[model samples]
Target: MSAHVFLHLCHEVGTSLEVGTRRDIMDIINTLANQMRTNLMMTSGSRREGFRLVESDLDVMYWPNSYRVIWELYQSHYYNNLSKELILCDGSESRPGFTLLYLLSPRLYSELQRACVRMKNRHYISSSKHRQIKCSAESQRSTLHGPCVGRHHGMLGYDLAHCFASDIWPPSASSWIDRSHSWPPSHIVDDIVKRGCHFVAIGHKLEKHEQNEWRISFSLAEQKLVYAMNHFQFLTYGLLKLILNRIINNGLGDDDKLLCSYHMKTAVFWAIQQNIIPQWCPHNLLYSSLTCFKLILKWVYEGICPNFFIPSNNMFLSNIYGEAQNFLFIRLYELYKMGIQSMLETLSITSCNECIDFIRDPSISSCADEDVLFSEADFDIKLFREVDNQGSFSVSNVQKCIQFLHIIEQMIASPLTQNQDIMLQKLTNSVLQNLAFMLPLNTYTQENKLKYRADKISCHFLKFAAKFGCISDVLYLAMYYYKTFRYTEALAIIEVIKVKLSQPYVMHNFNVDEEMYTEAVGGQSWSTKMGQAVAWNIKLNNNILYISELRPEQQSSLQNDVPYLYIPPFVMLYMLEIFAANM
Candidate 1:
């Protein structure tokens, strides 16, 4: 194909995330990260680098300080029991959150017989569901199969990950490949070293312990590369992901898990390492993307996709076999020949839907009353000198809180009207009063800060959307602003709502729920059905009914002893009510 045609196709596939959508994603991530500080951590891919297309996942990591604490407990009782196995804490009885990893030597695995004896004595009485004992051998080699997980709206899901910190790399260097002064800018390098690298245990086995190895991951390094990319280079990576997901992967069927977007990423990394930057100019975006595809094909043919930092560690070594590799190579070749036409056909519907949704979501628009936002808002609030600390919050109380939130959500979601102002005021006052009453029930982490005053954080976020007026969600945006003391930003969102009436605000996507199903059944039809049933039951029981914990398997990997990060529902509703009243 000629250069013009390729670049045109690149433009079509290289759609970047919209400004508002990007901000919303970041804000959601920040809120979650802050709330779950003791359990989960957050990061981004295409969303952060600005070259995101229709197909991208918001990847994050889950690691509580408790994981480290539990590991230390086992470490303290180290001994050469003929079984050589270290009793990593059992996570079987925990809630669905994150997995507990156990590092075992060959000698230990044999003696432990896939079972750990309960420790005889302990200094402290344990409250965590995980036991102080050895674990059975995992049914699958991949950590994702065993314990690696994330939760969304009470459902469990999977996202890409590696270790948080590694022992092999230079502690000071920014990027993983610190030697010889390679491609990424100096600033990028500095960031990598500061953030550090993680290790992924590959080829974990029950019978052959010697086969296991630690693969050094340069995920942080790759993110730096994407961020540092010129506009054209960003397009190149987006096109590559499109090709992998639509062409090669679709050909392998939905059940196929081999050759993910990460493999394509490593191929691009390898090309850059070989000094292919000159060929990766803006005009040659499609050409560069094609070149990376060829690199992937070469690796697939040889049954080896090298880790960018640690070349000896092959990423595709276990994920694919000869038949699968050959099949993928052939499919990718077919896609290369089809070229721009194939991408246009494959991405048309998905891209169009994304654009349509981006325009629909209101969190992107400002709700300022005039052209500018106000410096201060005047909402009636009765500050209490003493809190109403009550009995232990029961399931019924939580159900009531959820009911109130749902009611407010429906009211805000309805179309705007002239008389709605008085109703909003009353609703806000009522919510605040109830929230004040519930405040004492929440066990505050710190008594000094007003931020710690509310137990359920989401309550402070109750938003009201008005036609050509400031929205309730904007009020939520205001709450975060108020907490950070950015009153101007908060007022700006509030003011915009007063100016122009617009379409009803779209609900935030609970995309993670779908991911939870995918992880539960590993994407098989029969098991997927089973997983759906299990998920529905869990959601009904844990969320709608407020009567249960996660499923045993789901709970096995994710639950922890760390106090729950989220504020109780009552506190969240109260805060949202107050926010709406002031707006």
Candidate 2:
């Protein structure tokens, strides 16, 4: 096939991105149609049926109903059967492999690479050249997707060794603690494992040994300490809060719990003794400067210091960049604790409307969702059993089981219902147990729910030991700025989060169901306008937005790239509306 024909075909099949600007639509058709027409294997004697599939179809070959992969080769001008030709020409035929060989089969894999190659010049190819080849190769060599740096963004078939290694709690060092070697116990590991790692251990070629990237020198307490002792106290707090959320959402153990509470106190101790509250954390940062500036900013702006934007992870903000969630940062821990406390008291008091009046804290009173946790004279037996089992079981020790149930219940009661199976039944059977407890006072069966609650509280405490990442501050600050009409400030904060926190958050919630959004939206009833506004304002002033949409775009350029543009659309609409409304 002629080179010109191949180039023409690529124009037709490729997106505007793949085709250079100069080529028009007709050029696309001529190149692709002619190249295939000209290929001897593709041409049947006097005439032949056309190339098998359309451009829209992915390039996977099949045997009737099933997919089949085989190896074959072709030459530019030769029409002879390749097997006999191979003996005559020897390896010197130096022929290119034309994927068109599949055309004879009932189902043919799309030969995208071959078609693209046929086009004129080597450099004219799209950025995705390395990514598109669909075959397994040598262990060290991989398809050319950019380097995986963020806590998120692993290539296809990604894996993290420590994720399910049973040694998750107590580590072998090389397996669990190191960021390069292990992943935090969030959805990231689970997702990577599901994607399949085959065997992704780091290897060395030199005779002399070097440190393994996976090996962690820092203890969990030290990791937490570093979190708390950082320049941004809010970050320490945020980390604590996130860990708490993970504990509550999943489950934690005694060691994990100790890490949570201890790190917080340790952090508080270090910060106070050092007098380390900053006036503000510039949109960019390190540890010490952050705390000093942030504390000072609060004092200057509010005329008084908060007890500290501190909380167990269970009670942290929702979205790190959500405007409505900003209010959450201020006293969210208190509200969450109170919610737990109230749920506990409800179990203790067996009272309903009666409990609402008793919440002394202002934050507790403000949370509308608090009421939703307990309602219905009718108790759900199945849900109760699930919660009970998940909360406290020694052989099973459903640590955060109780808190997880509450979250699940909240998720179920919330917008997550818009989607399917946000929470799995397997999870339900474990965490949510004893439906008798949630039943009405008169109908109660279980005398005490403390075991479940205690286990959950314990687990919530453990999650603190895990590294608390940066999004906590972003959430806190973004929410604060948005609530106060400080749109520009919020945007700036989100940029910092994208730079640092995004990968961590993605790792943590990697396998999380989209249903959580439904839960957050459904149960939490977050305003679409507010969500969008917070998202966009951060985009414009900060020059960071559309990260989701830009994923495919940024991926190809990652070697030389830093994400500068790409904010969520929701943010754009919301900001514009808010700005317009005020004007």
Q: Against the hidden reference, what TM-scores do the models get?
A: 0.49, 0.17
> How many clashes in each structure?
36, 75
Q: In model 2, what is the error at residue 503, expressed in angstroms?
A: 35
**What shift in Å separates residue 264 of candidate 1 from its native position after superposition?**
1.0
Highest lDDT among the candidates is held by which one? 1
- The digit string of per-residue lDDT tens for model 1 on 106-218 reads 23344223322223231211212111111122222223422132323222222434233322233222234555266676767666655545433332322122122223345
> Which segments of model 2 are wrong by more than 4 Å?
1-200, 203-227, 230-583
Encode model 2's per-residue lDDT on 492-548: one tens digit a residue: 655654554333212121122233323333333112211211122121111111223
Model 1 lDDT, full chain set: 0.41
